[model samples]
Target: MNIPEYLTSGILESYVLGAVSDEERREVECLSSIYPEIRQELDRLSAALEDYALSYSALPPIGLKEQIMAKLDFGTEAPPVETETPVVALPADSGPTYKITWIAAASLGLLVLIFSFFLLSQLRQAQRISATLRDSNETLQTEIQRQRDIRQRSEDLLAMLRQPEVRIIRLKGNDKAPTGEMMVYWHPHSRQVMVEIMNMPPLPANQQYQLWSLVNGQPVDAGVFDVTDAPQKMGRVIAQADAFAVTIEKRGGSPAPTLSSLVMMTPVTS
Candidate 1:
């Protein structure tokens, strides 16, 4: 239920005035226990009533006790009454004490309300920042994985080239491009070959570089690949070749190397 609204309604005032029905008094009592604000309001009303009572509090008029005693004559010769010490009752608490207590409680409630709102705002902002950081962390993890794969491939290629059985073949450019150069790492025993574009000229958009292995004087298509900062492992050469060459052909590469587009070639040494 909307406790604040119910507290603000006239029910509390009626409860304070002792004018509410029994059902309403029970409801108020129940709510007061359930809601601190309701309880605080109830205390405030009680404090106000105490203050009102204190405002009109005074000593009884002088000699009024004698008038009450004279009215009750002791049958014109009743036995003499025994005298005893009269005791006066004092209130356990003063009006101002209740007032101070209520004021302190109300102030505390206000402070609690303000602090709660500030804390809630901070929590929401923290959640937003956390979400953003989580997304960034995921993106960074993906990029790190991609780099790791690249590094692993580079390592594998280096390990292959370092094998004692592998032969390094340098292919020099022909008259079409004198400065273009490339290298091939070939393991004759395993027929494994890795291609590295050292200083090859950039090809047109619709063309790509293709490797060819010459076996028995016939050109065999090795594979087609792009030039990157790292060496690329091409398809394994199925047969021992006497020479290897590079040519620029259509993007997907031709089934046969175009002799006219040949850029560089190197004959196997051993």
Candidate 2:
């Protein structure tokens, strides 16, 4: 409504007497904020009521002011100091700008450091595990290589033994070596008979044991051999006959075995 119409509605009289309803108070407060004239009128109305009230109380008994002041002071020598200072305490976990930012940054940094330490520790542990696994793999590879070598040797021996024409000969201890024993294998097709000597100590570096194949009544040099065959494969080949022998011959072997070194001999089966 227009200002004149609002004034004519008798609402200004109610406002002047503090009788404004709650709804009317809100409307008047909004209008007063928007309109300078309305605000001025409200201010003037408040002054008028104040002045009217003062005029109405003018006949009050004198000495009322003195009575009010005397009761408050009790006639003390020093006036009391104002003990009530208004303190605006901020809420917890919230406050000034510098403090809030500092707290937030410090909290984030601590969390990052903790996580980084944890990640580093895990990485170190994983490296240790990888090293252990590498060592284990190397060990397994070494064992596999050794097994392969042994299996190959065994397979070679088995293939040789399967030949039907392979000869087997036994050599008894010689007269000087009463209890010494030996054997010979003569595979005619392969022409590779082996000699096995028992308790024949390791040969000197430049010396070796010799084998002899007796043909007719004469001793013929079969070949020289070493420790690899001394225990399981031994002996000689006789083109014409039936006997084999072993002796501590020289390194290159003797066309004829030294009689004193004669260690063992065997006769072939017909």
Candidate 3:
């Protein structure tokens, strides 16, 4: 149990104000008896509230007794009217008791009002905590799902690479980019193609890298890709190609390749 957290949780204030449910009341009582610090704090709060109530005690108005007596008929001969109910007379010494009862009732009412405000504050705090926890749980779930997808993609890529029919092509830098390099995986039977960036220079925001398959001296648009370390799947190579090349293009690939922007190229081998 985190003692400091429990101490600041507002349960003690609720317990002292007599606003806690029976189960919570019992928990407070049990914990207070077991912990000296809790007991001391509970006693201090009780004393403080008692002092506060006494400070706000209502006092009787001045000359109240005299005013009441002045309004009564003290003359010996007084007319009496017949009534269905009999009038009950109070004992002469009931003044002090009545005064004490009235003060006690007023103090109880003030305590009740204070307790209501404290409980409301506690409820608002609890609602905020609940909302924060709900958001955190949703974020955690999204991250977990993202990781699962990444793992599944990695496993699939490994399986594809192990196939006997797949061919590996290493494209080296051309005159346009002396240090750029890339790898291409091609499955002739399935016509599937995947590209991996080994090394590449960064491009401008408005430009991306495009893959081209040269067939009968004509460049075919394979796909466009971003510069990332992960292996990316591209358009299938339906016909056998003589070579593969990469070029810088607009955000999306164009119908024809820009020969001047060629960065890497590799000729196919039998």
RMSD of each: 17.9, 36.6, 11.8
Q: Could you give the candidate ranking by TM-score, starting with the highest?
A: 3, 1, 2
For model 1 the local lDDT of residue 78 reads 33
What is the C-alpha local distance difference test score of candidate 2? 0.66
Point out the worst 10-residue segment of candidate 2 by lDDT.
89-98
lDDT per residue (tens digit) for residues 1-270 in model 2 = 588646445455456555678999888889889888788877886786555444433232366445544555533244445986555443332223344444555555545544544565466668768888999999999989867765665565567679897777777776676776666767776776655555555668887778887778688788787665323343444455468877887887877779888877887786
lDDT of each: 0.76, 0.66, 0.79
TM-scores, all candidates, are 0.47, 0.40, 0.53
Residue by residue across 162-212, what tens digits does model 1's lDDT show?
Answer: 777888899999999899888888887777888777887787789999999
Measured on C-alpha atoms, candidate 1 has an lDDT of 0.76
Among all candidates shown, the one with the greatest TM-score:
3
| lDDT per residue (tens digit) for residues 127-229 in model 3 | 7699889999999999898777667766766877998878889999988889888888888887878888889998999999999888988888889988875
Give the runs in model 1 whose Cα sits over 4 Å from its true position. 1-146
Pick the lDDT winner: 3
